[model samples]
Target: MFPKPIEKSSRSTQLTYQALLPVALLLWLAPLIAVALFAIRPSVDFTVGNYWGMPSSFEFFENFAQVFNSSMPRYILNSFMITIPTVIGAVALSAMAGFALGVYKFKANLLLFFMFIAGNFVPFQILMVPVRDLTLDMGLYNTKTGLILFHVAFQTGFCTLFMRNFIKALPFELIEAARVEGIREWQIFWYVVLPLMKPALAALSVLIFTFIWNDYFWAIVLTQGENAQPVTAGITSFNAQFRAMYHLMSAGSLVAALPPVAMFFLMQKHFIAGLTLGAVK
Candidate 1:
């Protein structure tokens, strides 16, 4: 039912795969390569239609420096403010909810879990209008708090799914033993289950951080300007009234991408472990 492993493939097949890998890699990275090249080029290069050609002059430091010299710093701080709170709130709530749903055997357990899963399948575009209206009604439209709250609510469903499954895979005997030893339910959860959940928590934190950090749609829709807008939306400020600063935008894009990339690298081991923890029998 599955294709043979590359190691088990015929010698010719292996050789062909190796030959095409670099080409495929380059093709996949073409847009990124183009953006990087554009980020280093002078505005005159783009003005003279020298795109995809040699840069007339390298302005790497100038382009990157201009990005930081703008209101990009405020936007980045806004991202951290919004994303960190959303991550903590969503993960915390989901962990508790997942523990309850996974540990308890309530009559409506499956129904409730299904409800959380259902929200994830719904197209978020449809909610944009109502969400915007709701935010406006609550006077939170264009505020970091509103963005953080919305992200936490929106992401909780998926986070619960991830946490519930991970918690479910945990040993039931530990809970039973804890109970027999007169450990209170909260204590069992806080002291016993919580420690074991570190890997899953770390993984989910990294995932959610990346999601909220890279979020452009809701960032633009829910917030505006450098005061509340995340770096993703704030990058658009590079567009001037008369002309677009493509080089500055490209540099800003690269800078905006760093936190999530750094986060993933830092938590790479835990992320992989959390994902693969319950996979094996």
Candidate 2:
């Protein structure tokens, strides 16, 4: 059974919830607050192990400027290059594949759908060595294309699961109507199904963009340097040989996090609708 809404709670329960809300909120935001404070602190504070303490001097602008002045901009661009292509490639392929699995009737359809779902359950760590060697053999190691391809492939299974369910929830009568009116299957999908899938597509795009952008493990495993490394891994560029630039790394981290945050906010409406499409009725 679900917990009742706060509005339905007794007066004492309401008071207790209200009293604890701010504390819970602060606890959730504690790490983010620490990171922000770290970004504004001068380098000396970190050198002297003054973490969790107030900054001796605020150097917010200077720290962020240093990050931009370094190869951070290149890494940001690389993130966009890799993230955008992967999102597009994964979503597009999944759309077609989902249509087939969700719309058509075939003996192997359920098996293929299960296979895609199974891929999601496989531990990614197991594929690390083989995936790296595969890129090397294909002459794509340390290349953005390689990273993009790998992300697309890895993401497709989850995306297919998302899209196929969304497609299945759509009224099958629409497809029948289109067929009766003499529209080709491709035309029906492109004009009818794709248009109706905007909410789902927007939702999936934001999700995939966030996942690919925040990926540091694959970034380090599959690519190297500013040419191919995304901002997530490139944040390590702040580390020097003798010491770590914690302040600069903090600034870089905040900068790297902005795009995905902005993406979610901008597409918030469609994302919510897409997710809740079949939850009701």
Candidate 3:
């Protein structure tokens, strides 16, 4: 909807558009398609002489076996360790902050809300030094906890903006009726607001999971090795070891990409709902 749809053009123009679609898609997916194809290609067949020829033998099992038996398992575990805690902490903090800003009419409400909104847009480098120092000072440097804390704090800025707007759009009458029933502030939040936040929670879970899972910068800055490094950093090390092993690298990339992909597939509905919540008037 960002760009207005084009009306039916001339037959020649339509033909041109149809012709370009496949070319565009192929261009976009060329790298992935090449990787997928290479994953099944025998190393002999993948020689420069036959890179695109019909694979002489499918080696997907062999490549996947190597990847599985390699550092991928530890990386997967690390990614989950970092992603899950960050998602929970960011969502939980944002939910509470969003409730206060959405429900209260304090003079600083908008100011605080905009502060979070603006924070999300700032360059991450500005906070890197301070955040890393804080993590080190806490003795969480080079640990999963360090990565989780930074992710939670950084992601909370965006999540708070999202949840605040989402909560604001809910009917005020619901809170009013609950108030009339003599519900305390915490009870109103727990019973009336939190229950209705299911869709928002699901949506954010998928989004944050993918973001944290794919994170590279903070992972490198905070974590050192397989002990605490997530898949992105793990992949960097993998790439170094397997410099000439394209098939293994491809398989590793696919494995690294699978979790977020699965999460999106599983929570597609909630994700879409959260994203589109404010699209309509």
Candidate 4:
């Protein structure tokens, strides 16, 4: 059962909750706040061992300019190249697979669906070595295509699960009506089902975009340089051999965070609708 609403709690409990909420919120935002502060602080501040003190001077524009003038832009472009294609490919394949599994009643349907779901359970770290070798063998190592293919394949499982459940929740009567109207299955899928699946597609797009954009482990494992490396990996370029450029790294981190944050805000309405679509009776 759900916990009682805060409004229904005793006055003392309500006051306590209200008092603790902002404190908790600030605690959660503390790291991000620190990073933002570091991004604007002059390098001399860190050199003088002033980690927590007020910035000696703000170099916000200068730091971001340095990040942009470097290969950070190329890294961002590489991320977009890998992530966008992966999102489209995974979503397309999963939508078709989900339709088959959810709309049709076949002997092997559950088995196939279970296989897709099973892949999601397997630890990705376990496959890293094998995937790297396989990519090399296929002559795809250290390439955007290689990363895009891997992401699409791995993400398809979760996308399939999401799509299958969303499609399943849709009214079967719609499919029946289309069939009764002499609509071909593919036509029904394209014209009827695909239109209804917009919310799920939007939600899945945002999720996959975030996942692939923020990926650092695979980026480092597979690619070596800015030619194909994502912003997550490219951020390391800010580091010097003798010393880490924490200020530039912080600026890069903030810059790297912008796209996903913008994406979520832009799609906020659709994302919320997709999540809550089936909640009501």
RMSD (CA, Å), each prediction: 2.8, 2.6, 2.9, 2.7
Per-prediction TM-score:
0.89, 0.89, 0.90, 0.90
lDDT of 4 by residue, 215-274 (tens): 999998889887999988877764542146788888888998899889889988755654
In the predicted model 4, the residue pairs found to clash are none
Clashes of each: 0, 0, 0, 0
lDDT of prediction 2: 0.88
Lowest-sum lDDT 10-residue window in model 1: 272-281
**Candidate 4 TM-score, true structure as reference:** 0.90
> Which regions of candidate 3 deviate over 4 angstroms?
1-24, 274-281
Worst 10 residues of 4 by lDDT: 272-281
lDDT of 4: 0.87
| Collision count of model 2 | 0
User: Which candidate model has the greater TM-score, 1 or 4?
Assistant: 4
